[model samples]
Target chain A: MTGSRRQRVAKAVFLHAAALVVVFLMAFPLYGLLLTSLQPESVIRSRELSIIPQTLYFEHFRAVLAEGHIVPLRRALVNSTTVSALTAVLCLLVGLPAAYALSRLRVPGRNVILGALVSVYFLPTTIFLIPMFVLLVRWGIDDTVFSLVLAYTGFILPFVIWILKTFIDRLPLQIEEAARIDGCSHWQVMIRIVLPMARPGVLAAFVFAFILSWVEFLTPLIFTSSLRMTTVALGMFRSTIDIQVGQQAAAAVLTLLPVALLMLVCQRLITQVLMSGADK
Target chain B: MQAVPDSPAIGGQDEWTRAPGTLRRRETAFSLSLVAPALILVAGIYLYPAVYTLILSFARFDMAALEIGRWVGLGNYKALFANAAFVDAIWRTIYFGLLIAVGATVSGFLIALLLNEEFYGRTLLRVVVVLPWAVPPVVAGVLWGQMFHADVGFVNALLFRIGLIENYRIWFGDGRTALHIIALAEVWKAIPFMVLFMLAGLQSLPPQLHEAAAVDGATAWQRFRHIVFPLMLPIIIPLMLIQFVWAMKAFDTIFVLTRGGPAGQTTTLNYFVYVEGFQSFDMGRASAAAYSLLVVTLGVVLMVTVLRRYAALRKATA
Candidate 1:
């Protein structure tokens, strides 16, 4: 008993230690990134080997927020937020029933539609990379925020639907059945029964789509050129070459701030999304 | 002639409709109506690009260079085959994919195994572990770029301080190390996702099996090898394949980090298409290159999947 007890304690120590190392490796670069954001560019350029910042600075953040900079951080924030929010709303509006139907309907060609939907995931974005530019240019929406939003919503639809459909499929069909027996119409069954039970799923899909959009680069990179509709992603990329290290790091921080906060708030739902997607 | 079976699938029991014998038709209409928005969006965004690829691949369009389309079918494909840069880009893409897939999957497996235990701060660590995943690719790339900077970069400073090297070595300079660093950043971005998938697989495995194996005098390694390995293979294989697909097609990280630079060391097939179309304005050749890449990627994925299935069959027979 004593030997087993000692071994169990040893195992626990190893587990905790391993977790610490994993956390450190994952968080160190990000910590260094945030460190640069908090410090002046001069200190970073001094080549000192300090991982922690000695003094906190806000000038870089200010410069990013300043009106006349090339990146235009404020416009970018608004543009990114608008695109992300609109993408989320648009995806949910379109994805809810597409997911529902895929999960629960007996429609003809169900498999074909579902199979086609997976094209985005399986194929390289480059297949559409060149052609999409031409297509968008031809559509006369090139370089507009609308073009970015439209492309992102479409790009993220397949994953969003897969997640939401998994959520909806897990719902007990008995209540839906009971609603029908109680003289409920199809709309009532969905609106009253499915919708009520699908709040968490809806939130999950929304947040997932929102994050995917917020982080998306290809659409903004290819879709928008001018600074008027620049996302922080594009701004961050542009800043890499044009801006100082501290300011670019600050931009990275600002871009990641909301995503990190949302992850904390939607921790369980996000985990559920990943796990559910994995299960399928 | 055959009666349709009543389905609780969707569209409530057919009672409020006038068409008594049109149950299938009604269900189809209702499903189609519900899915109309998505269909339209997908059609607009997905179908158009896909269909347009076919036409553009055949026609010559370098309008920016004052060239016009001549509808030379197969000419673009022939040119693509002869293009060394395109071939190099494809190989580089595969090389990057292989490295990232192996690195992320292995690290993810270890982390998932570690996290599967009952421990303190498990939930907190789970959230922290997924922080990298939540990071947007371009930002993540930039964060890494900051780390890899030669003058003030933390990577060099840390290595020098630790006496790993005589001086700070450029992490992203030469063509050789550029792709490796890109792979490293990608591994950082991808590990969380792979961990999530592996954790799901881990949690789904019944603890009873492990317990029974333990009580039957199996060592830990033996128990894992005989029980966990086979069960986890399915999950691991598919997740790894997905990771491979993402790494093979990934552009933003490479674009932001090196822009396929240091003499085009990191120029993936995706990057090649981007340059040809946007930089050179050769939409025809770019389209052809992209189409070829798509076929090869799909073919590789299918081949791997079939090979895995075959191996599984052979092991069972043996």
Candidate 2:
């Protein structure tokens, strides 16, 4: 029995060691980013770079945060926040009802529409880039945050609808019927019952939409000009070109902050959504 | 089961239990109304632009007027196909996409398998895996770019210390190595997503199957080969299809890292379209190239779907 117990312990140790190595591989880049961002430029450029950081330097962060240091990242943060928030709200407003209809009521050409949405979801945004750019330019909204919001919604709405549909599909129809028996109309039942039950899914979809828009690079790169109009992503890219390694690292860290926080807060919920999405 | 006039309408149970024809009509109307806004958004944004681009692919685009100048049927396509550089980019994109797909899948499977085992700190490991997933592709590119920087990079520092190389090598400056480095960045970002799906697949499997196999004295590898892999196919196949499409769509990493540099070795179809449309302003040829990419993506999806169906049929008969 002791021999078997020792063997079990050894196996456990082996499993943990393997798991830690994998974790290190995954987390190493993030660690490097954080370390580079925190250390002084001298330390970063030093010949003997250590795995562990020994200093806490805020100069890079300070420089990045100040105005005119690669387009004022604070303003870019606000812009990204505003665009992503609007995109999420729009996704919910436009996606929820559609998801509801598809999951509950039989829409015409349901299969065909669903298939098309799947294809659009998989499509590279380059396919839409040229014409969308032309249309936006004609509409005189190409460089605005609102245009970014619209473009983001165009791509992200498919995913939002698909995810919301998955959530709504899992809901018991009995409660919806119960609401109907209570003399509520279809919209009333949806607004009152289904919406409340699917809050977790709704929240998940909203967070994901926000993250997707927040991290988007190509749309903002193509659609906007000028540093003031740029996003955190574009600003960071522009900074990289400027070869301000310290500032770039700091900006990258800042860019990661909101997304990291969202992931931390919604990890479980996001996992649930992802798993459900995979099942589909 | 009979609908009767005597049933009370107050409960609204009669409304549900009543004949379906009228209710279905109302339901269909309501459904359509609810779906209309989403349909309009998609139609305006995706469908309209897609159709316009399709037409633009066959016509000369007037940049000044921002409209079609003249119809040049197949001219742009012929030009693209005739360009050896463009043709090489097409093949390069396929190669890079296959590398990303295969790398992400194998690594994702191994990591998912590791995470599936019961161990301490597993939750922490799972959570940290999502870091790469949340990191923007551009930022990931910068991060990895720094790691692989020709000088002052940790990779060089470590490699030098370990005697793996005598000097710090330029990773991105070389055409041969640039594409692979970008793929590595993409694979890093893609693995968490794949792991999320693969872990879900693994978790959904019945434990009894494994326990029974163990009781039959099957080794872990044998049990996995016989039981786990087959059951995981439904999730794996579709996941891989999406991954391939995503890898093809990947451009930010390439954009940030190489900008299709080192004599355009890293230029994939996605970047080619961007450069053609935006930089070169040859909207006609760019549109044609974009359509070519779309066709290839659709072809891949179709091929995978057919293959899956064939495999399922074979399994059923077997």
Candidate 3:
């Protein structure tokens, strides 16, 4: 018994050591990015690399925020936020009803429609970019934030519908029936009964759509030319080409912040949703 | 038909019944009202653009020719097939998809298995694992690019310090290494997402199965093979297929890292389409290429769905 216990303790120690290695490997690049962003440009260009900053230079952050061609950065952030928020709202506006129909009402061709939407979720958005660009140019909205939002909605709606539909399907149908018997109309049942119950799912869908739009790069990179319409991702690309490492890192950190916060805030729900989505 | 006294039909409600006409009408209206907005938005934004791209593929709509261009039928597609660069890109994309999907899925599953253990600071470790995914793909690409820099990159710095290399090597200056490096970047950036999903799958699994296996004196490898692997397959297969499709369309990472550089060695099909459309302004050819990619992606999706259905049927029968 003692021998077996010792063996178990040895295995535990080995497992813990392995876990520590994994954590270090995963976090090292980010730590390096943070440290590099804090170092002055002259120190960064020096022959010898310093693992730790000798003196903290917060000026890099100020320079990134104040000095460089920040107009594009500012515009990109605004555009990204606007496009992402609009996409989320639009997705909810359209998807909630479709999900309700799928969940509650027996519509003709419902199964086929659901299957088609799910398939479209797997389809590559890049495939549609070329023709979408042409159509946008023809309609004179190619480079506009409006086009970006539209594209984001189209790209994201299928996933949103799928997620919401699953959640709605799991809801107790008897409650809606009770509401109806209480003399509530179908719309009333949806607004008063179903919507409140599916709040978590809706939040999940909104966060998903928002992140997708915010991080999207291809559509904007191909369609837009004006600096005013660039996204944070595109802004990072421009900064990299301009060799502004500090600004690039800062932008990278900023872009990551909101999504990280959202994930932490809704960790359990997001985890469940993401797992279901991946599990098919 | 006799009215059934407030008894709503449970299963087979006829649409044209006179007794339930009011109920039927209300249901129809509700259904239409619920679905109309989504249908319109999806059809207008998604379906129309896809169809329009198909049509553009068959036409010779160059900018110089403008609206005066003639329909060339399958000429654009034919030209794409004949173009060596395009063909090469398709092969590269397939290779890239296979490499990164397999790499990310396997490594991610391993990491998930590790993280699933009851260890101290597990939450902090989870955060660390997911950090790469939180960083925007563009930023991740730039970070990797910086790391691979020959003169000042941390990668080279570490290697030189460890005496593994006599001098810093130009990692991105060569075609062969450039594609692999970009693939590595994609794998690193995307593995965290795969791990998150796989970890969820692992956690959802019943621990009693492992306990029972252990009681039966099964070795660790045997337990993993006989119990864990089979249980996880349901989630693993679908995630693998989706990851494959996503990798095929990977662009931002490659774009920021190499810009499909070192003489177009790292250019996947998606990057090829972007270059053709925006850089060369060859809308006709780009649309054709994009259509082909769309067809392939759709084909893969269909295959995955059919596979999932088949698995479900088998499980039901068993």
Clashes of each: 0, 0, 0
Runs in model 2 with CA error above 4 Å? A1-10, A239-241, B1-23, B304-318
For model 3, the local distance difference test gives 0.79
Clashing pairs in 2: none
Comparison by DockQ, 2 against 3, better one: 2
DockQ of each: 0.56, 0.57, 0.47
DockQ, candidate 1, vs. native dimer: 0.56
Question: Would you estimate the TM-scores of all the predictions?
Answer: 0.94, 0.93, 0.90
What C-alpha lDDT do the candidate models reach, one value each?
A: 0.82, 0.87, 0.79
Instruction: Give Cα distance to truth, residue A188, candidate 2, Å.
Output: 1.7
- Best DockQ among the predictions, by candidate number: 2
Q: Would you give me the overall lDDT of model 1?
A: 0.82
lDDT of 2 by residue, A80-124 (tens): 999999999999999999998888776878877788887787777
Per-residue alpha-carbon lDDT of candidate 2 for residues B257-280, written as tens digits (9 for 90 to 100) = 999988999999999999999999
RMSD of model 1, in Å? Answer: 3.1
Candidate 1: deviation at residue B317, Å?
1.9
